[model samples]
Target: MDAGSMKAESRCPLQEQFLQRKNSKENLDRFIPNRSAMDFDYAHYMVTEGRKDKENNQAMSVCSPSKEAYRKQLAEVFNMNRTRILAFKNKPPTPVELIPEMHSSSASASSSVQQAKLNKPRRHIPQSSERTLDAPDLVDDYYLNLLDWGSSNVLAIALGSTVYLWDASDGTTSELVTVDDENGPVTSVNWAPDGRHIAIGLNNCQVQLWDSTANRQLRTLRGGHRSRVGSLAWNNHILTTGGMDGLIINNDVRVRDHIVETYRGHHQEVCGLKWSASGQQLASGGNDNLLHIWDRSMASSNSVTQWLHRLEEHTSAVKAIAWCPFQSNLLATGGGGGDRCIKFWNTHTGACLNSVDTGSQVCALLWNKNERELLSSHGFTQNQLTLWKYPSMVKMAELSGHTSRVLFMAQSPDGCTVASAAADETLRFWNVFGAPQVISKSAPKPNREPFAQLNRIR
Candidate 1:
């Protein structure tokens, strides 16, 4: 017969069975009688066979399938087809204990997979955009004062009696000193550059130096003053603190124990304090509206107790002062008065160079180490930041953001960013290449009655 005639005449039910089987395991001999099983991806078929091949460690590859195999097994299994046996249908699943290591592909049909999504841990965020904010933030722990970047190892006196030491390298904090009920909210804290020790100023005219490396409070000088501790500053080896008692005390940290020296000068509460960049002198400001520069080198005998120079132009209490790290003779002082303004003066000559005016009371002053620009914050007023050129005191730009009050400001060591703290306790950062922007606002009192009421009703 011709090929066309043969094609029309040939017909077999085998082709129908081959077309329907999911695994297509109808035995190739029933279709292409001469084909070998090697034509298939045997590794794939063996894995999908849903059968165990125990004899051949590797699954069937057109080879042996001899685990308890042969005519006897065939005769015994002949009575029951796959559907009648039913053991494979309701087989107990792979134990939950063994599922962790299994990485089943998504194409797999078995919904019985018990794999845990541990490698891709899910974050606890209700909103898709909610991020798991880390505590050891890149900049959150960087503490700063008028003197320097309080950005390294730091300590803070909080809740009156709680002395908290924080490693600024990362936000790892611990309550190191708890001074009973007599303690008031800590007004000042300082960490020596070496990070070996920390000094905390408490409300009760006391300066306590604690060895952070030793993890113990080393000593406390009670004879320094009889008033509430208000401000403290320290460098690598010295501690200088001024308090409501109007006394300035310098503690030598070089000694194993704290050695305290009292400088009698400011007649009113000393509200601001800073050490000279070279550590040769100490400057303290008082409610007397005076900035007194003390010759710290005069720690010797009967030297008359008085300021080397007194700056009395400021009519109100000076709140902050920044000593230039590059030049000890140049300094800037800020105060709160009827009209908000800051006074920049020469420490050596007591000459007022410029008086900078702000829309509100100035809370903090930050000087750029590399440049001569000064950044200041106005207490809770719009457009509170005044960035000005030094000496000339010309306004460079005004930064606006804090809706409540800008209480503190610090320029990063590199001057790439500036951090401003507000009465809102919200630390906002600004990029100066273009202009400063307000990112967020956090109230200092997070759990206050207003917030409490909102949460309770919610």
Candidate 2:
């Protein structure tokens, strides 16, 4: 090769190396402090030594190619490290601190969803009545279950000493049987499940079975109670009667010696008696402010331990007792003047599930078979009937009409109608338990005025 060409190529490599070293020194000074000062000292040494070597040897290079190459490599590495440090210092912020915030947001969202489910709106139900009839001379006793509507659409009511049968379909009333005044007045009345036989409980402590269709007394079962018989309930051929003597008797109507089983739990008058729809459980409430739950298996045993659960939460008389048609384990009972509370119990576990203050004396409680609703009849201040939505216990409607307190209530076989007997000497049929109806724009509403008025007997 020619000398000029070789010299130019070697000078080019040295110039490029020097340029790279100069740029790296500038970057180091801008990015790092103490390291930049060291790089400046090394650069000064290279420049001064190169000038001296050039003067001493004209044909040779100012510095050894190997040392120059090494310096260049060090400069390249420093530039790369400087670039990395600058990138790290200028990088964007991370979201590491937001992890807890994300969790809290999710937790709040789940709580909101659960609350929305609990507060969901319920269906709006209308309150109205279908018909009303006068229950003349109807006893006003709170402890007596004087009214019962049979499955055959016949209503049997005990007014004083007379037992009357009124055919709901034909509106014809007939006297079933009249008890002797010596038997004290008929305190309670209940019909058999088959709607063929009716049980009459007397103030004389006697329970009698009668064939209502034939208008004949079948037989009188004695040794029921020491005082007045106040309540009666029937499960098939077995009739249960509660009395003022605080005694409960179960009579099997199919046999002659009808007194099959006896239960003694209350210290005061046994005023309420009800059998579950399945006839597996019997719930009785008494004036002693106590509630007793009895299982059918207890009927076979003559032992005093037949009492399943003796609940004493009520401070006053517990004359209101009912078995839930939907839940067999559930039983509801209400207290009188002093307590004024309705408590629901799980009979299987003997746990009180819920309780509600009625604001007045709760005289009677009835469950609607068609809907998840409960009807509670009240006495004292308002003397009103309240329809409540079950489980939630929201008051759907308050019915007012009876001038006196409604002490007794009954449900019809269809499950859409309810008959409430009040001290006003009137029997009112309410459609409050019926399913809500939808009225179209073209159809006109019926006259609701009759429902509010008293329909006295002709």
Candidate 3:
């Protein structure tokens, strides 16, 4: 063959093969699937399959030869495959039920919670007096404070012109001293805070001091009060005396010039006198229906008046005065028969905090040391002792035994027992302020030692 013919023949075979490959690629393209159908059409088909299945089942039931025959045939096919594949392979286990014991414990816990919600706090009720003693010839005078309980557990009372000391431990009585009839009867009696000395106020306006243990007259504080001395209070070494002269004198017992300071505020007789526990303030009530609070600094100052607060809220005479031991600024004062009210004042601001109409003549007021309670002695219709809750002023209990008015009440140093002397000539001991006690014979008795030596001037 010729060279040109051979080359032409080879080129013709190659072109044929290329044409064949091109045709094969076009054929495969027609059979292969597209991603559009797989992504969009397949997802739409799956979402609509449930509705289509319901329609198909309904149509198949009507078109089929028999519905029972179709279901039985499908069940037979599924049962045959059940041996190779299990149903509900990923199902969770069942939860266990609670036991009977656990149910009972839960119910009990709920009941206890309910019970605690229904409980409330209860208040305390004070008891009545434990015992009573005869105080024959006890002078029933409203202006006089004749009953005083010493720290040594001895109670001193003035009956007529004689001063008697009653030992509470032994239940025995002894005469301390007696004044002449010409010098007048004892108007008031006060014991020193140390329990060693006793102050006797006479109707003749003479103040006498006596050593309680030795039973000897220490000295007579003279030229202090012109009129009858009705009240007396001891503040350490200084003795304070208030009298009908409407004057309050501060006498230093250790010094010769005992009349150190004199306070004048009331126009009527000064009847009530009390020194605060801190010895910083002095409260005095008078027949002028006035209450005065004095400061300790006034004694050393040159001011004309040493009165801290001048209160005039009472319409009648104010003979009952008591300074609160817990609150220093609180002061309580009771009016006479005409007013018949108990007034509480704040000494700091000179303001009246509260006042209660007792409905009867309030003779004296005593605050409990251990509890927030107040005790009041009354006269007239209800000649009894009423224990009241402070601030609220609620009457907790009413103790009635005395036929006459209770004029004076004195608390022991222990702040438990109280001795009340009434017009019935009886001195009753009440545990109204504290709990009852049964003192045994083996208990160590309180020391009856005498106080430090005083400057005796016979």
Candidate 4:
């Protein structure tokens, strides 16, 4: 079978070996320049000469033609005139009015009038308090919110086991209610929007709604929290209460089943609660060094409601919460003794916009309803009230009279006065914020010259 076939097989191996070596040599030769074919020295000389020519051209460009002429030359050389004509690198300014007419006299007059309004004199604030009253037995606990001013111009404050109300209009003081030994001390008190109904939080985990006009209890709400209710805020018909059990409950006062929604997040007592002016959001601060934002639209009675934001930026307990009167999204919260800082937050985005170190404990915060200013009550070494300009945070004035820590502060209905109750047991009212501006609608009639009336006689 054969010598011929065996010889053919032997020849096949030699042919394949030759092809393999040839392919390898071809690949290796691809990267190597052709030394014999290409003029290496000439190529190098051309590159060097071209580089020198470019440098010389760049040097001569010091006295070159204008940019427009150069662009025209480029367009001509490349036949790009059509493309250049269609492109607009800089557009002309837009006309304010369609028809060309001069408005100089009227425009200048209106602008001058606006400038005069802008230059109005600044209001004056008194350095000393205008009045002072005795707040005997006012609770000194930092975690308890025991003072609030109602829209009715009535201020309610809790003292030990009894709650008292003072009418700011007539300067009358009256007792609101007193809890028994079991539910001894009142933890918090807030007035509803109607100003006639008040919500009283008790140490025995009870919330009472009372009618100030009739001076009678409306009802008692239970099954909301397991510990003492320390903070209370009202939104329309709904009453929000935060308790020592780290729970926030929304009670709808109109329905018999008052416990409507519950917010569960904080691990410690919630001491601060404030509803925004729009009544769409609620901000709560607790002893766990946490701040939570709850949205009313997301709340449900069937399940535990989720918080819109859980801000853990505070290093200590947060008790002071105030929503800006001018801006709905801006919120201000103050940290307790350990933190000694006031932080501004954008509630919609949950971003901390600014923070200022107060150097002392911030116990309460109140915003002027008529002005863009803020008032803060501090404790410990200073025990003074600070009036600050918002956004700038400049210390406008520092009023000091309390001998002990200023634990509570409330603003008057007109936002002209601030009542501060300190651990010193004295309630001092300051005329810090000036009276609201009164706009005059009446304008003086222009007087006619004597000769101007002679035209009618003629």
lDDT winner among the candidates? 4
- Which residue segments of model 4 deviate by more than 4 Å? 1-118, 439-458
Candidate number with the higher TM-score (2 or 4): 4
Better of 1 and 2 by lDDT: 2
lDDT by residue for model 3 (337-437), tens: 99999999998889999999999989999999877889899999879998889989999889887889999999987787787889987777787765644
What residue runs in model 2 are displaced by over 4 Å at the alpha carbon?
1-128, 435-458
TM-scores, each model vs. reference: 0.57, 0.68, 0.70, 0.71
lDDT of 1 by residue, 270-345 (tens): 8788787777777787778777888766665354456688778877777677887667788888776454678777
- Give the Å error, residue 339, model 2: 0.7
lDDT per residue for candidate 4 within 378-399, as digits (tens), equals 9989899998998899999999
Question: Which scores greater on lDDT, model 3 or model 4?
Answer: 4
lDDT of 2 at 155: 87
Of 1 and 4, the candidate ahead on TM-score is 4
Alpha-carbon local distance difference test for all models: 0.57, 0.77, 0.80, 0.82
Question: Per-residue error at 283 for model 2, in Å?
Answer: 0.7
lDDT of 2 by residue, 232-253 (tens): 9887667888888888888776
The TM-score, computed over Cα atoms with residue i paired to residue i, of candidate 3 is 0.70
Cα distance off (Å), candidate 4, residue 198:
0.7
